[model samples]
Target: MPRGEKSAYTDKQKRQAEHIEESEREQGRSKEDAERIAWATVNKQDGGGKKSGSGRAKPH
Candidate 1:
């Protein structure tokens, strides 16, 4: 898939992912870990589809 392109996920899937992310954040993940999970599940790099936590980190 190209950058910015999207794949469909069920509403339940999305909600579940959001919950996971929120939980991770609440648990105090080093920003890097949080960004990775966001990208993996939501397809948004670094939480906003671009450099987050500086250019050193790549979304997972």
Candidate 2:
């Protein structure tokens, strides 16, 4: 995948990013900054897209 392509992200991840971006905007961050921060936050939490096996392991 190309850089900045979100095709590997799950629906939930996308939703979370969108929400984070909106929150950052509400807090006065610039549009570009908000988007960057949102994706960064998501990556920090989820460790990038779901195609990676590292962050997908969870206890049931």
Candidate 3:
């Protein structure tokens, strides 16, 4: 699943996320800014790649 998974966002994390978002809003982050931030965070955490795991299906 993608990083935006609701289960991943705890109450504390949610608050922090919202604060940063609102601050970004004030800073005029723009749509592209939000997208880039999300993509960069996810990619950085995922070894600078687009996905968390290798691009392969799970073995059944």
Best by lDDT: 2
Q: Candidate 3 lDDT, tens digit per residue, 1-60?
A: 686454544455445555655666677788667655654554344334323446777445
User: Which ten residues in a row are the worst by lDDT in model 3?
Assistant: 43-52
Where does model 1 exceed 4 Å of error? 1-7, 30-32, 38-60
Task: Using TM-score as the measure, name the better of candidate 1 and candidate 3.
Answer: 3
lDDT against the true structure, each candidate: 0.58, 0.93, 0.53
lDDT of 1 by residue, 1-60 (tens): 576343445455456567777778999986678656755865442243323245575435
TM-score, prediction 2? 0.83
- How do the residues 1-60 of candidate 2 rate in per-residue lDDT, one tens digit apiece? 899999989999999999999999999999999999999999989778876566766545
Lowest lDDT 10-mer window, candidate 1? 44-53
Error of 2 at 17 (Å): 0.2
User: Which TM-score value belongs to model 1?
Assistant: 0.44
Best by TM-score: 2
Instruction: Report the Cα lDDT for candidate 1.
Output: 0.58
How many backbone overlaps does candidate 1 show?
0
Ranking by lDDT: 2, 1, 3
